[model samples]
Target chain A: MKTALRPSVALLLIAGILGLVALAFAWAGGWLSPRRIGGAAIADALQDNLGKPEPGWRRAHAKGLCVSGYFDANGTGTALSRAALFPAGRIPVTGRFSLGGGDPLAGDGRNVFHSMALLFRLPDGEQWRMAMDHTPIFPVATPADFVSLQIAGIPDPATHKPDPAKLQAYLAGHPETKAFMDYMKSAPLPSSFANGTYYSINAFRFVDAGGASRAVRWQFEPEAPFAALDKKTLDAQPRDFLFVDALKRLSAGPMRWHMIVVLANPGDRTDNATIPWGAGHRRVDVGTLTLDRAATEAAGDCRDYNFDPLVLPRGVTASDDPLLPARSAAYSASFRRRAIEGPRPDALTQAGEGGAK
Target chain B: MNGPDTLFAFPARLLHWTMAVLILAMLFIGAGMVSTVSAAYPALLAWHRPLGIAILVLALVRLAVRLTHRPPPLPADLPPIQAAAARVSHYLLYALMIAMPLIGWAMQSAGGYPVILWKGVALFPILPHDIVAYGWLRRLHGLLGYAFFLLILGHVGAALVHGLIRRDGVFRSMAGRGG
Candidate 1:
């Protein structure tokens, strides 16, 4: 009995040891698993940190703008005046902006939101894409949400007019859009193009030469303070008031805007576009962007350019934002579709032509 | 007979062959479902959940049988390292078989998605909604899938080496004789 018990006890001990080892291995594997953040986190971090400016922030801001390929050298030694940020560089970019469909020709003086796509071809040839919106936060977070809003806002085919009822219902369904809508409704339209501020809606990783990475958001603030447009002034202005204002500023002396880089806490999700980042995460200015030259229509200055976010520097990488991936897919599909259909000659030519009733 | 003169007993052999056929069928069905796009594709997906549960249940039974029954000893001429490797590989295959289905089920549950094993038959209750947990599980599922693929490749490669290069009866033992 003693001998039989010893063999059985030894077998049980071996099995127990093996089982414990397996459990330990599984536990360690699980603990070492990688964690990924979505696009919403990126957007939040960028928006939360973009209010104040810093010294290194200007170069970083300029880097982002340069990456967007929006700024060019004016040949007068000033780099910002030129319309093309990168003259002969190829960097994929995608841009989306919201404009009132009710009169492509009517200058209602209502505030328009523009999301700029800037893809920069770095010296190392890596592409970095930036999604810059006129407002700090986008109205909607996801493509699905955006599509729903768009569907609700679309005009009836038969009537060729927007259905107010549908629009109201849509807005009611999505109460989360209230903050964005409030900002849009309350923020005064810039009377002059130079007064407008552009924002990076998504958080981006800024890797320094030392390999230290801090999440950042960027803002382009006009040197001149904002002058709000009144109803009388808006009505008096031509339909192309915004475009003309931009062209006039360019035609004048070099246009300069301070580029502000805002630093953010890596883990914070407050400013994630859907939710507003509180005062604690205030933006600090980093640098200045001086536009020294304006491009003529003959030079294809206003031609459609795409900006993609997957373009990053050797050190800089993207956060796994759900919206970022969805946006990337949607932008790629839209850009490919648009490019195949050729440029919108009418919209491009309209700004320079200058016709008034 | 005490048992077959193999690493596996009769019950283990039956379980192994049954699972092998079912899992092979599942892999083929999964590949086909992914490639084919039709109205019936959702219907095919509907079949996956039930089949996966069935496989999971059978794998549990196999594990239980393996724990109770002592498998036949390796060939006396087999090197200690090679025999150890064979045992480890078999254990890994079993571990993966047990894990993959559970991970897939957890992913669906975490995503707030239904995991209907059969028409109106729910094998497990839905997990509470948690985005972070869902993301982690999704990434985990993807990582494990690659590992499973690699292990399968290694297993197949080792089997071929034994059958052809080493000219060992390891493959034939599993393949059965008189074929």
Candidate 2:
């Protein structure tokens, strides 16, 4: 009886040990955590990326400023409608330029990158937020990996130096970043905004007046493409040179960017921001945005702004791109955190309160 | 084992291990669901929400059982401070297990997203669209998640210390053996 029981006890112990080991692995993978896998950090990074100063705008509202255009019921373009998205007939737009380093204040002016967002209100009294980065494709899909990249790019809090080994390891592991790297290497980091194309890295849905819906990605191509800045030119000028150029444009006249919408196939997942979209899906001209007014930094019109693709108009919806949903969650969480900590008011709440209108 | 009740029961132990396995499986699958960059993956998201709800329900049942069932006493050799710490930690673990899933459900509900526990079974009726509540609940969810991580790390550390450093039967009691 003792011998028989020994085998049974050993078997039970083995099974229990196996089960516990499996469970530990699962929990560590983010199963037991409240935040979804890759959800928390993605949200945090997006908030961090968007919550900075543009030369002209200060964060006035949290969700973002809104921009509205008047269109007849038939959807034919009419004159610019009442700026329902912004209170003063202008939505506060914030722009941020940086090298693609994780640190908020990393001043490697060599590979200049720019991200701009327009927070405006629509005619229907809803808040609209749009954000884009210099590089089109995000480096990694996982929030953990994104956090790792941020840590690698950022200076060590104690030492104030970036870890070269970690950065090299990260770059080596993600070869897909090569396409974006190639683009950055070839493209000029300009004092003027005329050299590079700023892409809406994530895909969005646009509904035409006819009720036809299409997945759209936006790219702002300069009228005349300029060669990328060499290492010598970058070292000569201060990092804020791009801001001065943009300010000059605003001072000169209405600065305009042709908003070209790249049409995506409904069935195509190739060009989703998480993965590369093939060149087969060509972009079509949608409309133009003319920045007629200068942005003021003292007015607090452009602080803590974030871009979520989910914040679209009635005609516009979001695609099933994994990054879009992840971004929506991330942006919402970050905005929420900032709002609670004070200084920045919740955009959605304020928009409802008629702050933007 | 001349001490106050501390060691968990056979049923409690079994439930703990089983729940552990299930929760871990859910996490692994959750990670895979996000990491796998394919169009077919959204179909998998349909599974994650429901599975999370199921885990939440199981956790609640486990908590109820733990509260009702009197566990075996800890080894008399365990100091009062260590025993108190163990009790507090266990309660925290239970709290985290229940809180994590509930917060996630509330966050999704506040976002006006569906909370389908199973394919058709709705856990809670859809929440009225409230952006303020959504924001508050989402932040709470994220904070609680970090808290949960800290608690888990502490629990693991204590267990390792007991098994490796203390060289006591404290680990074996939970390890399910009569020495």
Q: How does candidate 1 score on lDDT?
A: 0.51
i-RMS for every candidate (Å) is 20.4, 9.5
Estimate the overall C-alpha local distance difference test score of candidate 2. 0.53
**What does candidate 1's lDDT look like per residue over B1-179, in tens digits?**
12246435667777888877776555544433332222223445566677777788999999999899876666678889988988999999898778877877886665434355643244453456343355566566556655765576566656655544454556555554411
Model 1, A129-195: lDDT tens digits are 5656667776776545655665566556667666889878878877767668888878876666567
Stretches > 4 Å off in candidate 1: A1-108, A115-117, A209-212, A231-236, A265-267, A282-284, A296-298, A301-304, A348-357, B1-179
Off by over 4 Å in 2: A1-39, A42-110, A141-144, A154-159, A207-213, A222-228, A265-271, A274-282, A340-357, B1-179
Q: Which consecutive 10 residues in model 2 chain B have the weakest lDDT in total?
A: B34-43
Model 2 Cα lDDT, one tens digit per residue, B21-80: 665555555545543323323445557677677778889888788779977666678899
Q: List lDDT for all candidates, in order.
A: 0.51, 0.53
Model 2 chain A: weakest 10-residue lDDT segment is A71-80
Residue B1 displacement in candidate 2 (angstroms): 47
Measured with C-alpha atoms, the lDDT of residue A188 in candidate 2 is 54
